[model samples]
Target: MKLTPIGPAALVLALSAATLSACGGGGGGGGAGGTDAPADYVDGATFTLGLSSDPGNLDPLMGAGSALFAVTQFAYDPLVSVDGKTGEIGSQLATDWTVDDTTVSLTLADDITCADGADLTATDVADSLNFVADPENQSPFLGTFLPVGAKAKGDDATGTVTLTLASPSPFVLNGLGSLPIVCPSGMDDRSSLAKATSGTGPYELTEAAPGDHYTYTLREGYTWGPGGAGTDQKGLPAQVVVKVVENETTAANLLLSGGLNAAQIAGPDGDRLEKSGLSAAETTGLVGEQWYNHADGRVTSDPDVRMALTQALDLSELADVVTSGRGGPATTLAVNEPVACPGDSVSGALPAHDPDAAASLLDAAGWQEGGDGVRTKDGQRLEVTFLYQNNLGSSGDAAAELAVQQWKAIGVDATAKSQNETTLTGTIFGAGDWDVAWVSLNVGSPDQLVPFLSGPAAPDGTNFSAIDDDDYQAGVDQAMGMTGTDSCDTWLDAEALLVQKADIVPFANNTVRTFAKDAEFETPGQLVPLSIRMVAK
Candidate 1:
C-alpha cells in the first residue's frame, strides 16, 4: 500500500518523484491559510493533538500505516526533506547532494547530533541505508524507498555518504526524504525502536503510553529540521502530546472544549468543526479504494471476476456517499501533494457502473445465480471477505456496507469486515485471509508503488493482492528507464493499465482536513510537527 495520510483506505498507486516534478512540481501550496507565522508566541508551551487511531508500531521499516509514519517524522530526521509547497528538495540531515548517473552522493551535515547526545556520523547514516537496502531484513521500505542492491558507503573524514544504485532510480531523493534515519542504538536493537526514540530530529520521545498517547520534548540547540526549521522558531511548542481518541464526536467535542489543540476529522464532525470557526488544513488524498486479492485461492483471482466486480457499482454515487458529499471523483492514484503524475487516470480506465454487464460477465465466467440470488460454481458460493479499516470515520463504514449490498445485488456475497489498522496490516501482510480490502496506500511517487503492483505477494512482499500483470510491468519498465518529467506519459499509461485491468479500484478523492484550535501547523499530507505551535488559550 502506498504511504499516505491516515484515512479511509483507497485503492490507488503512487507517482514517481520524477513524474511528480514533471506533472506540476510538488503540490505543496497553502491550504486553509492558518499556517502563517503567529503574531503572538509562547515558548516552552505544550500542544496536544487528537488522533483517531494508535500508530501501531513506531518502527518506520516495519510499520505500514500513515499514522505510524506521521509519528516517526517527529522523532527521526530524514537524510533529505522535500518542500511541500514548492516541491523543491531541501536539506535535512544532509547538507548537500549530487546525483551522477545512477549514484547519489550526499554530504552529511557535520554538526547534527542524535537525541541521545551522540554525534551523528556518516557511518551511522550508511549503516541505516545499507540495512534497509538488504531485502533479507524484510523491511517494507526495501525496494519501495531504498533501491534494491543499492550500496551505501560513508567516509567519516569528510562526512560523506555515497549511495551506489544497482539500477536507475529517478526519485532517489524523494524516497530518501520519506525514509526516516535511525540512530545506531535504534538500529542495533530494532525491537527498542517500536517504543523508544533516537535521532537528529527536533523532538525526543519523552513518554510512551502506547495506545493512549505519546509525549515528545523539544531538544535544545537542535537546528536540523525539514526546510531548515530551528528550535528557536517563534511559537514552536516545547512539548507535543499526541492523544489517541478514536471517536470523531469525542474528538470534535474536545476541539470545541479546547481540550485538544488539533484533530483530523471528516464527514459530519468535520463539517461541524469547520463551521465553528476552527482553522482546518485540508489535504487531498484518495479514499474508498477497492483492492481484490489476486491470490490463487481467492475468487477475485479470476480476471473476469475482477472486471465484473468493478462494473457492479456506481463509483460516482459511491464517492459521494463515502465522503459524505465532501469529495470528488478520483483522478489519480497519486493523490498526495507533490503528486508526480497528476492526471485523470480514473476516467476512461475504470469500468463504468453496469449491473447488467456485471451479471452477464459473471454468467459468462460460469457462475450461475442460485435461488437466493447468490452465485455458485462447483458447489462453492461466490463469497469474498471485504476488509476495511474501522478508524476511517462513519462514511467509510457506510461505503463498505453499500459496496457489500451492491455486490450482493450482482450475486457476489461480499462480507464487510471492519478491522483496526494493526489487525488489517497483520492480516494483509501476515495471514493473507482477506479477498478484497479497502486500504488507501498513497505514496508521493509511482516508483514507490512498484512493490505493491508487481513484486512478490504478502508473507514475502507487499503485493498483498498478488497482482502480476505483464502489460503493466512492461509500461513500468519503459517509464523507469526515462528520467524526470520525461517519464510522465509512460507513468500515466502504466497507471491506466492497472485501472483498466481492474487490478485496483480508486473510487473517491477527498480533501481531508485537520481542525486546529489554539494551534497552528502545516498539514501538507500529515501534521508537520516542526511547524506546530501553541497559540494563546
Candidate 2:
C-alpha cells in the first residue's frame, strides 16, 4: 500500500496520508445546524463533500494518494469492512472468512454485482488480489496490505477465494478491509479506470470534471454494504459530489452555505465551524510526522546527524504550531482510532529538545560550524532540503518555517519546501530527491507499515527512506508470529526502536474533524458508503 499523504482527510495505506484524512472518525450522525437535535433525514438528496485536492486516478490498484483513495471508496468494495468504533470485522463483498496462520479463506456474497451490471464472482476478486500481489505489477500495496508472495485461488462454483500467505500475517483480515476489489472489466482494460470506475460498490462515477468535481450516482438494489447493510434506507443520498476545493476557508464557507454536505477543516477555520454547530465525524490521526532519507550520500544517512536534527527542534512547540494548538503529542504511528495495536510507543522514546546537545552531536560528527554559522564537514557545507505537504494550510507552513529556523540556529542550513500531495508522493516514492519530509502513512494495522519501513528502497520498493533497523526488523519478525492484539506489545516495542533510533519522528496527533452540513456519515479513514444519510438543511 502506498503511503497516504497527510492532508485535510487522513490517509490509510489501507488509506494513504492524503486519503486517510478523509477516512478517519467512527460512525456518527451529522450534528444539528445550530440546534440541540440533528436535522431530520431526507430522501434522494444530493450530497456534496469537499476534498482538499482532486483524486487524479480512478483505478483502484494503480493510484496512490488520499484523493484517489477517498474517491475510489465510492466505486470499490473491499472484501470486508472494519467497524470504525469497535475495530470489529464486518462483511462486504465477502460474507464470511476464516484465517489460520498464513492461510485465509473467504466466502463471497452471491448477489454482489459491478457498476456495469456484471455479476462479481470469486474469480474477479482473486484476480484483483493477484494483480496487486504480483511484484511485476509494482503495486504500492504489494507487500504492505497484501503480504509479499501471497497467492489467491478462486472457485466460482463454491463462491470461495482461498489465499496462501508467504508468511504468518497478524492483521491480515484488517488489511483486506481496505483493499478495494476491482471488477473484471476494469481489470481487463485497466486504462479504462483512469477517469472512470468499475467496481462492486454502492456508488458509480457518472461525472468527472477534474480539479472541480467528480460525481457518483447511487446504485439501486445495492444491498451488500458494510455489515450487510443495504441502500434502501430512507435517507440515502441519490448522488455524491466530491468537490475539489483546496482552500479550507472556502470549503467551510461552502459547508455553511449548504453548498457542501461535508468538508474536513484542519486549520483555524475549524474553530468557527465548531461554533456553527455543524455535525462532525471525528478521528484522531498522526498529522505531524517527520522522516529522513537514510540512503547513501544523504546528510541524514549518518545516525548522529539524524539525531542532532531531531534534537534541534522543540517538538512540543512544533506539534502545537503544526496543529494550530488543536492536537496533542503523538503516542503512536498508528493513530487511526480503533487501531490494531493501541499503545504509546512515541511519548518518551524520542530524543528531547536540546540545541546544545544537537550542536555537540554535529561537532562530534566532524561538522564544524564556520564563521558564517553554517556547519561544514570535509569541505562540504551541511545544507539540508526539507519538504512538507501543502495541504496542511498556513499552520503547516508556519511549522515548516519554524523548523527551518530551529535547524539554522543549530548551525545547519535547512530550507523548507512545500509540495502538494501528488508531487510530494512522486518526489518521495519515485524520484527520491528529498532529504527530509513531513509525511504520515496512516493504517490501522502495524503489519501494514512493514513494507514501507524496512523493504527495498523506492523505485525498488516502498521503503522510501531506506530505513535499515535490525532491532525493528527483529521485532517485526517476532510480532508477525503472534496473531491480533496478542502481538501489540511486540509491535509497540518495534515502533519504539524506530523512534529511539530517530528513523522516524511522529510528533503530533490531532482529532481530524470532517464537518457535515446536511449529511451525516462515518469515515473510518474513508467515508463508509452505507453510513451516508442525506438530511434536511
| Residue 104 error, candidate 2, Å | 1.0
For every model in order, what is the number of clashing pairs? Answer: 16, 28
List candidate 2 segments past 4 Å from native: 1-39
Each model's lDDT comes to 0.76, 0.80
TM-score of each: 0.93, 0.94
**Global lDDT for candidate 1?**
0.76
What C-alpha lDDT, on a 0 to 100 scale, does residue 402 get in candidate 1?
A: 87
Tens digit of per-residue lDDT, candidate 2, span 345-408:
9987988999999999999999998999999999999998899887677888899999999999
